[model samples]
Target: MKRREAREKAIQTLFQLENTELSVDEAITYITEEPTNSFYELLVRGTVQNQEAIDNTLTGSLENWSLDRLPKIERTVLRLAVFELLYNEDVPDRVVLNEAIELCKTFGDEKSGRFVNGVLSKLTKK
Candidate 1:
C-alpha cells in the first residue's frame, strides 16, 4: 500500500486502540487482511510506543485546546503526524502536515482540516 493508505490505516488503528482495549496486532488485523506493509506497522507501533512523548509534544502546540479535549479523529491524526514528525526522519515535515490535514478532511467533520492544519502549522514553525 502507499504511504497515504498506510497513514489512513494507522490513524484508524490508533483511533481504535485509544477507544478500546485492542492490542496493536489486533488493531492491525482488524484494519487489514494484508497487514504486511512495514510502513503501516511501523506507524501504528511507533505511534503507540511513543504516544506519551507525542502527547507531550502536542500539549505545547495546542493553542486553547488540550489534547484530551479534541475529537477522537483529530486527536488520532495529530498523534500520527506528531509521531512521524518526531520519529520518522524519512518523510518531510510538510508531507506530514499535509497528510494530517487530509486525514482530518477524510475522516472528520467540515472544520477538521483547518483545525489540524492550524495546530500542525504551529508545530512545523517551531
Candidate 2:
C-alpha cells in the first residue's frame, strides 16, 4: 500500500480500537489485509503501546480542548499522528503534520483539520 493509504488504514483501525473493546492485537488482525505493510503495523502497535504518553503530550497542546472532549475521530487521528511525530525519526515533521491534517480532513468533521493543525503546531513547537 502507499504510505498515505497505510496511514489512512491506520487511522481507521485506530478508530476501531479506540471505540471498541478490541485489543491492539485484535485490531491489527481485524484491519490488516493479506500482505500487510510494515509501516501500518508499526503505527498501530506503537500508538497503542504508547497511548497514554501520546495522549498526555497532546493534552497540553490542545487549546481550550480537553482530550476527552474531542470527538473520537479527531482524538484517534491525533493519536496516530502524534505517535509518528514522536517515534518515526525518519519521517519529516512537515510530512507527518500534513498527512495528519489530511486524514482529519477526509475522515473527521468539518473543523477537524483545523483543530488538528492547531494542536499539532503547538505540540511540534515543543
Candidate 3:
C-alpha cells in the first residue's frame, strides 16, 4: 500500500487497539484483508511500543488541553504523527505534518486538522 493508505490503516488499527482488547497482530488482522506493508506495521508497532514517550511529548506540547481529554480520533492521529516525527528520519517533517493534517481532515472533525497542525508545529520547532 501507499504511504498515505498505510497511515490511514495505521490510524484505524491504533484506534481499535485503544478501544478494544485486541493485540497488535489481531488489530492489524482485523483492519486489513490482505497483508500489510512494512511501513504500516512499523507505524502501528512503533507507536504502541513508544506510546508512553510519545504521550509525554504530546503532554508537554499540548496547550491547555490534556491528552486524554481529546477525542479518540484526534488523539490517535496525534500519536501516529508524533511517532513518525520522532522515529522516521527519512521522511521530511513537512510531509509528516501535512499528511497528518490531511488525515485529521479525513477521519476527524473539521477542527481536527488545525488542532493537529498547532500541536505538530510545536514539535517541529523543537
Candidate 4:
C-alpha cells in the first residue's frame, strides 16, 4: 500500500481508539491485521507510542475547536498529520499538510479540509 493509504489506516485505527476504551495493545493488534503495507505498522506504532502527547498538543492548538468538537474522522486525520509534522522528520511538512487535506476530503465533512489546513498551518508556525 502507498504511504497515504497506510496513513489513512492509521488514522482509522486511532479514531477507533478514541471512541473506545480499548488498550493500546488491543488497538494495535486490531489495526495491524488489516491488509496494509509496512508503513501502516510503523505509523500505528508511532501514533500509539505518542498518542498522549499528540492529543495534548492537538488540544492546545485548537483555540476555539476542542478536539472532541471536531468530527471523529477529522480529528483522527489531524492527529496523524500533526504527528508527522511534529515528530516524523523524514516526512516533509508540505507532504504532511497535503496528505491531511486529502484525508479530510476523503473522510471528513465539507468544511474539514479548510479547518485542517488552518490548524496545521498554525501548528507549523509553532
Clashes of each: 0, 0, 0, 0
Ranking by lDDT: 3, 1, 2, 4
Off by over 4 Å in 3: none
Q: State the lDDT at 115 in candidate 4.
A: 91
lDDT of 4 at 82: 75
Reference-based TM-score of each model: 0.96, 0.94, 0.98, 0.85
Q: Per-residue CA lDDT of candidate 3, range 1-126, in tens?
A: 999999999999999999999899999999998988999999999999999999999999999999999999999999999999999897999999999999998998779999999999998999
- Write out the backbone clash pairs for model 3: none
lDDT of 2 at 91: 95
* 2 against 3, candidate with superior lDDT: 3
Worst 10 residues of 3 by lDDT: 101-110
The TM-score obtained by model 4 is 0.85
Model 4, runs deviating above 4 Å:
23-36
lDDT of 2 by residue, 1-126 (tens): 889999988998999987799987787778875667899888888999999999989988988889999999889989988999999997998999899889988898669998888889889999
Clashes of 1: 0
- Candidate 3 accuracy as TM-score: 0.98
Residue pairs with clashing backbones, model 1: none
lDDT of 1 by residue, 1-126 (tens): 999999999998899999899999998999898845999999999999999999999999998899879999999999999999999999999999889988988899769989989888999899
